[model samples]
Target: MDHIFFFYFAAVIAGTSVLVVALRNPVYSALALLIMFFHVAGLYVTLHAEFLAAVQIVVYAGAILVLYLFVVMLLSIRSEERYHNQLPVAGLLGVTLCTEVLLLLIQSRTAPAVPRGSAEAAAETGNTEMIGEALYSTYLFPFEVASLILLVAMIGAIILAKKDIIETTE
Candidate 1:
């Protein structure tokens, strides 16, 4: 029963991800990406990590997809530009990478070992609480730095949009 839902969610995510790449229109691609994000969140839910599921939807599907839509709209890309194919080189590289991955998987004999951790400790702590403690206590600087990088990216997007407006007005 649970396996069914997980496979369904995984399928949807994979399909939407392909659609995201295959679609020519930037807006359509972004919408497909949004679908993929939600399906990923669903997968996280199946993994019994509700906080991760919510964060996946909120941070990625909600905020990031909206930002992608804004950039797509602001750019005002043309039909010809959207339809332009860089597929030959991209396809070759993609195929090469896929083959390499397949080879690596086939050649690997040993099953990956799981790290030894206190099961009782983990059972007492919810995924969200554990993640929060680790992020805040152990990885505080890197987390804050990521936030700063996102802020810079937002500012950069605003500046670029403004520059486009100014240029058009001139």
Candidate 2:
């Protein structure tokens, strides 16, 4: 039963990922990418990383995909009539991506899997306390800087999205 479920999920993930790059229409590609992200969250769930899976759905599927959809709708890009023989470029990019994925798979196959602490054990040990200790003791500056950068990016995006006004007065 678990084997079949895993196989089905892997198939869906692979299919949707390929469709995301193969579809000529931008909107269809975006939608396929949304599906691909959902499958990725499902894969995370299978690994027992519930928090990461929730973040994947909320950040990638909810926020990023919505941003892509907004841009697609705002541009009204329904067809490939504006593209200039980009199929070859797309094929090259696809080949490069496949090669990278192949390399990653080869590397992972040789690596031993690390056992994770059970969620119950982690909770009993104090999950929030452990996370806070790690972040503050080791990764404090990097985490703070990253948050600052994200804030700047959010402000920049809002500014760019605002409409421009032109005045003609004689």
Candidate 3:
């Protein structure tokens, strides 16, 4: 059943997300985050948002996780070990944030489900096509701005990464 699949995917996402935060080793935490991303993509599929699922896998799981791994590898392990003492403070902050989010969720009541379009109509047109039409038409400027922001961030990361390499060689 759909409910069963949803629950399974949700469980994987929740477990992996917790592991991502709980793991001490940066590499292990990144791997756990990768698992969480894939499970989130699975949830997108369950929602019939296949394009979003693909983007989630390609962007987050593929590109972003690779970036995280590269950064983790580039950092000095001895320096990282020095930060072990900060874990307790980080854990306390994380717990506080989690409690706040849970309280917010509990206070918020779900709205009634409203269907935008019929399943048959959506199936006939396809979800991706509809999304593309709206994204390019109604949301074109915002989309372009987001892409530009991401491009800038990527370039900044590359510049920072190379600066470290250049410094070490000098």
Candidate 4:
């Protein structure tokens, strides 16, 4: 059943997201983040979002997760110094925001709207080829913008990895 699949995906996504937050080791956290992306891509597929799922896996899980792993590996220093994040105000603000969102969610549980699109759409135009056609034809500008963002991120990552040197003759 589609209902069962949705619940399965939602569970995986939520579980992986929580693991990403609770995992202390940077590498484990990155792995959890990748898992979260994968589960989210699965959810997109259930919703007839073929293009979104591809982008989620390719751009996020493939590119961004690799970048995060490289950063984590680079910062694998053996210093056991404990660091404290002194952000009491920011923490309180975040808690407050979460509580407000919880309240909003509870209030909306009484009357849920019918979901758009049918299961038929999920069967039709569900492959990478059709998704790419839609992206390049209908959403060309947004796709170009996303590519630009990825280009900038790649450049920034390279710059971050570069070592600066100074030479002097006395």
> Could you tell me the lDDT of residue 80 within candidate 1?
40
TM-score of each: 0.78, 0.71, 0.76, 0.69
Residues 1-170, candidate 3, lDDT per residue (tens digit)? 99999999999989998888677788998899999999899999999999999999999989989988987887744324454687789989989999999987876667555667768877889889999999999999999999999999988878786757767777
- Writing each residue's lDDT as its tens digit, candidate 2 over 106-133 gives 9998899988666786656554566677
Candidate 3: where is the Cα deviation over 4 Å? Answer: 76-117, 164-170
Residues 1-170, model 4: lDDT tens digits: 99999999899888988787666677887898898899899999887677888889999999889978887788884432443475577679979999999999998898678787676764665577677788899999999999999899888866665666222221
* TM-score: the better of candidates 1 and 2: 1
Clashing pairs in 3: none
Question: Top model by lDDT, which number?
Answer: 3
Pairs with backbone N, CA or C atoms under 3 Å apart (clashes), candidate 2: none
RMSD of 4: 4.0
- The digit string of per-residue lDDT tens for model 1 on 7-120 reads 899899889988887887878998999989888888888777789999999999888889888877888975445443776888899999999998888877576766887779
Instruction: Show the lowest summed lDDT stretch of 10 residues, model 1.
Output: 78-87
lDDT for model 4, on a 0 to 1 scale? 0.81
Candidate 3 matches the true fold with a TM-score of: 0.76
Taken over the whole model, the C-alpha lDDT of each candidate is 0.86, 0.82, 0.87, 0.81
- Clash pairs, candidate 1, are none
